[model samples]
Target: MSEELDIPEEGTESLYERRAFVIDKGQEPLRIDKYIQMHLEGSTRNKVQNGIDAGFVTVNGKTVKSNYKVKPGDEIILLSLVNPEHTVLKRENIPLDIVYEDDTVMVINKPANMVVHPGVGNFSGTLLNGVAYYLEKQNPGLDEDSLPRFGLVHRIDKNTTGLIVLAKTADAAAHLAKQFFHHDVKRKYTALVWGDMEQDEGTVTGHIARHRQYRKMFDVYPDGETGKHAITHYRTLERFHYVSLVECVLETGRTHQIRVHMKHIGHTLFNDWEYGGDRILKGTIYTKYKQFVDNCFELCPRCALHAQTLGFIHPVTKKEMLFESPLPADMAMVIVKWRNYIANRKEL
Candidate 1:
């Protein structure tokens, strides 16, 4: 997403416009809601104020109050439901592996190859579609509009499998969103990466932003010149010569944080096609080694990353809640193959 504002041309009416603005260096501090009303056409102070109250407006990805002062270079994003670009969420009968559910929240063990929400190319058959269907079935009179992003507080990549939490009500959504925005949620992931880590454990710190050339990919900016600050702590679990199983704990949640951070430190996740981990980055070039890697790739065709653990304070209960999921079949099988290969080679 660009840090530039999407101001419509003069006299144009865009009631549902999704607006983004990067405050200029010379910008003076102004109340966020007032600033928005001044810049947004066909908008009232009441509407902007209401949007801020409803968490529809964010400053640097964190929800803020109407009175919050917009500082220089602050990235402000405002979303409106009336926008034509926003898709009407469809309720589909897609299957969901729901791990836990209550009146306030729902935790799901998302499968690989499943998009979290409907988008341009994937307008249906997403996790949100199935969640809509399930929520409606559970409560026949449930209002979909009351829930933002279909109750999604956070999301993993499409090919990244594992635990995700969803809010069931507006109040719950607000509470969960606040927690995530403040980085209060505890998230841990298991990743298979190329090469043996130089240290048993270390931290990767950098700013993450969309690549200048590759729009679909993100890159690390250590100079603090661009991107949002992100931090990831990782520790090796087991080393398999050419690959290592590792656990990652995130302090800040940014797009592709773990994947990009791991790659930045020269240990890209195994078979992470987006970050150039699909081919052999380490180990011998023997034909036998190539064949073994090919078989492993066939076993796990997607990125070797899994969100294994999630922890947060329950919106309603106000108590700490934690959940864990085992690795999916494909990843587990590939790990087992690496283990067996190491053992057989040792015997030989």
Candidate 2:
């Protein structure tokens, strides 16, 4: 089911307003108090717990305890604002899943379908928003131009899941940005695409730019607008009758770099229906799983891209650092179903 909600612009009296949400799978066991504390746009632990206590946070049309666990497909009504005060990013007693942190750098395993930073159509519910809050709350006057953003370095796409780095100081941010610019940050991705392998391994090297007609899309070109150079190395970890499991390595991180380059080749990722994806599954070789893929592409909305690994040098200590995230449930299930299809067809 699709939902289009326009938040009311009222409630200027209180900084935080109200919101509604319907939980998807894998979010079960999430405590009401803790979920609101972490996921609310700019809400703090005290505010969220208070909301829970005040009967504002209703679950399935009833007031529940703060310890109430959110089951899959549960309906949660969050009485909160889109973006609250304490500046762009404020620390609000939220817990971070930090993999590694030092004086200069931090590595985090970002969950899938999460935006790294705030941009258009996303002022909250972002890693950046949370990071900004964390920095402002931790260090007074930390947002000075000399040391902006608690040292956020490189970024990953909203739907593209993976590892990312953060800078606690300005020196670290600048240094890490330089490392990414020089293509020194080691990045890898795991994706299940919809195609048989022409070769067991390959590379797609090109420049990428925003699509001419499709404003939200990116495309590759032989000679396009001063686009940065990018290279992608991929190998079939496992091959099925129709699709292949590919491991992608990035040589340059550009906007939608890997997604665009991968599609530039004949292999569009299994769940990617954006770059010339017809709602009706296309491609002659896809006959095996076309119907199933069509149904999946319609029901499962997220793309199949995932940032499986990230590695870089510590901007301050000059030491190496790494982080990784596992595949999200929906994507994993898609692969599972497709694998079953391949095995049955193989037996036939």
Candidate 3:
């Protein structure tokens, strides 16, 4: 019998096709590639061998050769970019804000309200579809199979605007994936939280997991509890009495790490719909105060979070690469309003 391990979400780990299996006690010894081909439906021998060559298949948490023999009770794990579902991709000419691109990689400044990948309620019109169309235009006969997951190495939330990197080749994807898995990539986000932070800078360390009651939301767990370890270091940039603008640097990227960590400390991100930031969590209940808060929300309707900076080593060139994006107009305008509000309040 075999069991599949839970795949980590896009932001937490490399969003690859992952499958885990444990060999049955009664099973006879078989070649690793052949065993994988037998267990993974629709997988061909050639494909399995290629995956093995690319260090996608591992036994007992270690990469192995295709000829390695699998024994009973052996744990086998496969991580590939190729999705077994083979979902047909529809290329749409969606406009993309390309920050930088080269032979092996590309950087994009993703806007708010755009889902990064196609899923449940969002099937088409994702960043991936747009990337597919863009890649097709760049290389007329591009074989997507060679560029798994459109070379997406990491992900940001749908409402978060900022820089995301993409690889163009299998080798590049593998290299970049390794970097993300090791937490070597530099990611910095700008967030406006509900309340003023007492400290200028500090780190929030906790284990993060999906909420028990609300499956869509995540909560921070105590250490050694039911979740992956996450760390976020934040520095206050500008403080508005009702809210504070902070720069968050991710030490470990778990799903909703920044949002959850901020909320854990009594300062949920402003306008974060999923975490109750959309409501007026801070500030007075006075009509005038409420109106000002509502106006700020209207200026930036979605989560007031931006993935402002991303830095990584070039997969092929092995050179350090860093990119920065200014806060989106909506978020910037909201900050301006808050600045004005504080200025006016001081005058009074």
Q: For candidate 1, what is the total of clashing residue pairs? A: 1
Off by over 4 Å in 2: 1-95, 144-150, 223-226, 277-291, 298-300, 346-348
Local accuracy of candidate 1 as per-residue lDDT tens digits, 1-348: 124664431111111235688988878889999898887666667656766887778899999999999988899977653322233678888889999999899999999999877777888888988998888888886654544342776788999999999888656766776677567888999999999888999999888888999999999986659877788999999998889999999988877889999999999999999999999999887899899999999999999999999999998889999999999999999999998898888543
Candidate 3 C-alpha lDDT tens digits along 208-257: 99999999999998888788878899999999988999999998888789
Question: What's the lDDT for candidate 1?
Answer: 0.81
Let me know the TM-score candidate 1 reaches against the reference structure.
Answer: 0.80
lDDT of 2 by residue, 112-138 (tens): 567665556665677765665666666
**lDDT (CA) for every model shown?**
0.81, 0.64, 0.83
**Which TM-score value belongs to model 3?**
0.88
* Clash number by candidate, in order: 1, 10, 0
- Candidate 3 weakest ten by summed lDDT: 80-89
Q: Is candidate 1 or candidate 3 better by lDDT?
A: 3
How well does model 2 score by local distance difference test?
A: 0.64
Leading candidate by lDDT: 3
Residue pairs in collision within model 2: 17-80, 18-80, 89-132, 89-133, 90-133, 91-133, 150-167, 151-167, 161-307, 193-270
